[model samples]
Target: MRVHSLFLYPVKSLAGVEVSVIDLDDFGPVGDRRWMLVNDQGEFVTQRKLPALARIGTGIDERGVSVHIPGEGRFHLAPGHEELSVLVWRDWMNSLIGPKQASAAVSRFCERSLRFVYMPDDTFRRVDPARVVDQKRVGFADGFPFLFANQASLDELNSRLKHPVNMRHFRPNIVISGAEPWSEDHWQYLTIGQARFKAVKPCSRCVITTMDPDTGTKDPGTEPLRTLSTYRKTQDGVIFGQNAVHQDGDHLSVGDAVIICPQES
Candidate 1:
């Protein structure tokens, strides 16, 4: 099988940026989920609560991120912002607070008091101890560094749904084509391009999947999740894709061949 696409969400919970090639570091993909939106209490805000975040656009360059909201103006987060402690999930993480103007602009769009923060190099946001095999760390992502989805699997889910949902609803970092439906469920190890990875766990489905990536509008029916639960329900939750961690190497590109190894018998 070959990699069909690569995506990076520089800021967690926003629409991701598709790229032809990605340079992986200790943090999986460079600039992936390194920034996040937080509320006054420093609690992380996401599309799960504020679907409007989906409309926020981010462009990353060597300097930093350029953020834009339609008809609302733009803001930027460059180096040398103030440091602040923000709460993500259960962890309190140290992050660089975006400028007040930028924060206010986003706050207006979100219709809440929000601040944008950037993950710094010194911070080590450890992955969940129970599921992680190695001493892996993530940025603002929910758990692992990478999330993988198979096209065939999505095809199967789409066949089940009355209105097919696109891949964007799932927000996988790596999209693999040419794999059998749900084949990733049996994969223990994989090598994509020069990078190696361990399939750590299955990603659970959530309400965020029901939100339209472009408009930030939610599907009243709570589809994909509602349908998946009937068949894909596990003790963990309704599941879809696999969460993974980078074992070694750097670059991954679209069309790179994928070599998989099933779990040992």
Candidate 2:
């Protein structure tokens, strides 16, 4: 399938930036969710708790990353700001305490005792339960920074809906067109340009997916998600998009041909 659009979330829970091309590293895309806001306990924060974060805008220029709010002024962040140390997620207390902390700009924006930091792509961090330590460095993501979705799937959902929905509701890092609806659901691995990604799991749906990205209103009286709940419900929850764990790769651009290889039975 052909790529329709590309996006990056420089910081988690905030509005993302649209780009034509992005450099795909081991963790995901460069500058994508490389920074995040966390409370004093070091747990990552997001729009799920702070919906206002959805109003924040992030941009990348030659200088570096810049954050902008509707009424709040702009703040710039230095590159590799969170590379000083490592941050770990503690399961005993369900909090994030770390040797690394959030940047001052991030602290001011969130207006809490939270710190923001970046995790270099070369660093290794452990995620609980899975015991699958991710060597591909992640920025300020809950787990992975990039979430890829298929445009055809969205179209299929919209076709069954009374009112149309924009892709913004899905908040994906990459939206590829030309594939059959929900084709990504069965894809075992996808190779776009030099980037290689393994479809690890089905991403569960949250209120965030039901929220109106433009008006900031919550509405789930729609199809697909509701229809999906009928059968796609996993032990964890209802599934929507496919989550991917990727290895390092070169830059991926629009119009780049995506190679899809389904898993063997």
| lDDT (Cα) of model 1 | 0.88
For candidate 2, write residues 50-135 as lDDT tens digits.
66677777889997777775555676765443333333444211222222322544555557666555555445543333623554
Could you tell me which 10 consecutive residues in candidate 1 have the lowest summed lDDT?
72-81
Query: Residue 104: error of model 1 in Å?
Result: 1.0
After TM-score superposition, the amount by which residue 253's alpha carbon in candidate 1 deviates from its true location, in angstroms, is 0.1
Question: Which ten contiguous residues of candidate 2 have the minimum total lDDT?
Answer: 91-100
RMSD of 1: 1.6
Cα TM-score of candidate 2: 0.79
Best by lDDT: 1
Candidate 2 wrong stretches, greater than 4 Å: 79-115, 120-123, 126-135, 220-228, 263-265
lDDT of 1 at 23: 94
Candidate 1 lDDT by residue in tens digits, 156-188: 999999999999999999999999999988888
What lDDT does candidate 2 reach at residue 200?
66
lDDT accuracy of residue 165 in candidate 2 = 79
